[model samples]
Target: MRFLVFSLAFCAIFTYCLANRPKHDVSEDNYLELVREIEDEIAKENELKHEAREKDNLEQAREENGQEKAIVGNYDEPPYTDKEISYLQLAREVSDQYMEEIRRENEESENVGARTASDSLRAFSHPSRRTQMLAEENERQDAELETLQMLASGENLRMRNLPDLTAKTVQDDPTCNTKLDCEGKNLNLVDGKEFRTITGTCNNKLNYTWGMAGAQHRRLLPNAYNDGKWKIRKLSVTSRPRKKVFLPSARKISNVVHKTTKPKPENEDSISLGLFYFMQFIDHDLAKTAEGHVRKKKICCKTPTKATKFCLPIVVEESDDQFDKDDCMESRRSFVVYRCNDNVRNQINEITSYLDASMVYGSSEEEEDTLRTKKAGLLKMSTEDFLPISERATSLPCNATDVSTCYEAGDTRANVHPGLLTYHTVFAREHNRIAKELRKVNSGWSDERLYQETRKIVGGEIQHIVYTHMLPVLIQDSVLDQHGVTKEYDYKDSVDASMTAAFSMVYRYHNLMPHKLNLGRLKGDGVETFEQFNQESVFQKPSFVTRDNYDGINEVTLGMIQSQCPYVNRFMNAAARDLLFLDKNGNSFDLVALNIMRGRDWGTPSYTAYRALCGLGIATTWNDLTNTTDQEDIDKMKEVYADVQDVDLWTGVMTEKKLAGSISGATQSCLLAMHFANIKHGDRFWYEGSFSEDQLEEIKKITLARVLCDTLEDITLMRENVFRTNSDWKRCSDIEGKIDFSKWQE
Candidate 1:
């Protein structure tokens, strides 16, 4: 049993030893073979390392040689160092330094090579030079076009002296002085013709170009038109005022904005005050003249009524004799005519007798002949009644040089033919009545209120001008029924010498019409009453049209709103919801309101809107921008906002710049005219001066009100811009010249 147990223990120990021993054992021969394989790999690795080092060392040696040569070449000497030295030792030292440099250079070279390859790859992937060149060309062309437009729109006068003047010219020559010579002179003369008053119109071929384009003729605005009535000429060369204000440079004038002020009953009545000056107009004729030594003239008639009463100085003596006041002629019954509120009539009577006796004597026939001759020059009358005087000198004395000079001293009234003056007087009377009615509504108003009211009236006048005359000119009579272009002008006159067109060619384009592109919101059902307009409610109404329909809709209809409303700022964003929003592609899309703060890449009409919002103050500063990822840019914008506020504070700074004087009357009138003219003609006039008759009719489709609004707005802008630019020029100056210093009647 002991022997069997020993066997089991021995077996267990043997099994444990076998389990712990190596699974595969090598003999000396196998181990030697493995060792040889390991040795071979180590040798190969060392060989590679040695080869790399040798190559590196060779490169270092070569680099060291090059540097030594460069150092010698650049500095003319080797740098000295403290060391035990020999030629080989020096070479080895230089080689060590160069080896490090070579290593660095290799790294740098690799880096540069990689960068060049990367750049090459990128260049290959990018768009071609042709595309870039084309883009550049397009940009350049766009800039040029913009510059041209800006130049054309600028305030500069193209005077008659310029070759481009489109007005008809009739040069006055001395040859056409005889009655038979008058046959060739252009005039509206007929034997025994009853004189009728007519307004003078500018007759220019350019003005009638539309007729040539198979469009209707355009007519000049009436003499009563504000722009027409007031020439707004540049101050005479001698009348130029000092542009700099007399006030201190830093001085600021406090502004007072009157909300509402009523005229007091105790205040002097404007009418009564105005009538005080009526004393200058009493009739001196029909007075009793005593016989012999300078007769003292007696009063013609007693004052009829308090309203019609006027103070007149009794003539104490005649020109031949000085004497005391005369009380005679009390029994002389006076035939009198008292026209109610006849300012001009009284004025004429006050001065006419002086002309009859004192200024010129026995010269009525001569005066009539001279006036007839002058009238012939105006092309409105004939010289048949006027005797030709090739060389004439006036011998009339008593401070009178001739009929014309005497007439001028009487305020151009006497020189103007009786027929023309009669018409002018009638027109003036009507205009004054209209002005008085306007004053009733405008009285006690602030400057802003007055400006707005005046603009509205002006707008109405412009509408009448375009619709009544200009439209007919643009669309010929044949097409008048259809309101389109046609090749016919029924109203033939000598003025229509160029038969190619019966209308003003300028109006024969879409840009010339007032209704072509209606941009105002006051069209259709949107027309608001005065009250609604005054309130904010007008803008609050739903927009019937939007920018998306802009191309298709009549832009003229929107002119009022365009003139009044903020075009592209907050209002645009607010209205964008209703309007069809367009992208650069003209594709309709939803506007991201936040993008306004982000700035637009495309045109946003931002400047126009800025002008409108200037009075509204709807914009916010950087502090107002919240949750913006870019805070730095926001901070900068805050600075810009402060500058903008400063600009608001310095409203008159522009006047200081003399920007007002820089703009001529022609510019102001042209701007106003173009605003309407563009609407009537369409887009052609926007960029070019040429237009077709079809374009003109398209313009006629525009509304009259919009044209007026645009015109008025342009005038207002011109005035404001001029004032701003020449704010510095505003200074204390005596209101002399033709301006009456007397307070204007309400």
Candidate 2:
């Protein structure tokens, strides 16, 4: 009854606030501020309602059982007292059925008749994967609690050394540490959520933070560390009389495997550069590993002993032609933390682990707030219909220039390259385009409601494109069919949606990048190449995407479609292999080297281990690798790795021959299958169920070509399948089944 009373009181308060809204016309920005203020009040009121309900439940339990019970009153509020923290800890250890009962009881107030998947779990006797994961979590927690307590007292981990937590954190504070721990992110999840959260929380009905930002990446196998502690993999085993694996340098592996002299083979499908750039764009959408403090090049490369604990510099042999003797590539370890006091270390995924176009909408609520105009529910953009220009007073982050300054967007890495930034600009336009269309029909909708609804539609379109248009190119149709990755209506609460660390390593398609990026126009007679750039010159350089540049965002966008991807073999172009992310000093990092070393940093199991896991026949010796890997590649692997089991996951993946009708190999195909399959099956609010049948059909009809046509005004022509170079070309006006937002009207 207290819950109902509090809710009624909240309605009265909210109504009064709305009634007191400005009678006089205000500036657009001021109007947005007022709307946000009301939204904040609503969130506060909802939080209070939860606290009151919990308090009521406690009192009721105490009276009936003749005993005291703890309650988390003002649950969502900060500065959680010890008693409240204890209650939260206690809640974690409870049985799944009990948690479901709590959930059912909580929802019974608003949804008495609705049945959830958990309702069926109540009748089951067998343990599930969720239960097993929880058990593993409990075990890890028991072990890691000691380490956390010790670390709390230890005078170590300076602000620079801390893993992904705020610099403001006083390391000794238990409350602060609790918030940083995995599964401890404070998120508000309620039943019947209309749209996915910005941070990817609440995707799982049972586990609110399963794939949320700051959550540890899911692992295919146990981390392989030398000490079984916090060390990068070096030794062959962590057991008795450990033999040093003496792993080959990541650079050496790169030189041997990717620095190919043989003639490069073109993509069999004649895939366009647009699809290659999309590979990068969507990858940014899915996962981003948290980076540690910026590396101090002098400390990391010159003085090893004085370096911060986070520095894990890659050694460049003295014989290397690129630099002086004893030079090392400056690097920092990824930010990691325990699983809420668990003993294991896990790298954090800094973005939402869904195909929800988080790159267009920032991953966190705080980040998202900066990207919105809050007027007519549109995202912030420049007057030129380009992304908003960066100004915290013109301080540059990447290779951005003052004239063609880096534009701010949902993701910071939007400025990494011209092609990637083009996608960001196009998607931001799409959001506003959808918002204005929605407003035309339903002007009565509040700013908040309109924004969320538009966000929902955009997210739906993104998922449809990824599952339908993108995955087929990356994997075989038969593999997708076998895994049911493309199927809708497979939402299972039991499935965990967390991204695997292996997928990050396997999806590095650096080999396909062309050495040069060309801007051209396809006119009546033939194509005219107007401008060109060495791909390295534009690395982290935002100028190429700006209107001032010769080949601006539009030219880059069109050129990418017209330009051909050089090849799809294991060999990387000179730009990617030797000049990627070329710093101001002209020093660049090797993509293949970075990928191989990251596997060590992440502690992903060896290539053979993953092969076994994927049901690809394992190689006990070099001779056994023939069926899975080519003979020539097996010879290369034998040269680099000390043992068959000791090969890096990335190296193994590259050498394996591509499957028939797919760009990926058998193991790569399996991992992608699992990743996409779980992503679809695990999401409680997946696009299919979230939209009406009519709306879903409209979304399905939408294509990347159609989106490009609709957004890029200058792009008069496009291929039906942007991924295929030989696909039939069409005029923008002739593109069929373009999404009509009017069908979305109430």
Report the number of the highest-lDDT candidate. 2
lDDT score, candidate 2: 0.65
**What's the lDDT for all of these models?**
0.22, 0.65
* 548: Cα error in model 2, Å: 5.5
What is the per-residue lDDT of model 2 for residues 347-409, given as tens digits with 9 covering 90 to 100?
A: 767777877878898888866887898888999887578888765312223443353456777
Model 2: pairs clashing at backbone N, Cα or C within 3 Å:
none
Question: On residues 598-630, what C-alpha lDDT tens digit does candidate 1 reach at each position?
Answer: 111111122112322223222233332222113
TM-score (C-alpha) between model 2 and the true structure: 0.74
- The alpha-carbon root-mean-square deviation between model 1 and the true structure, to one decimal in Å, is 41.7
Give the range where candidate 1 is weakest over 10 consecutive residues by summed lDDT: 251-260
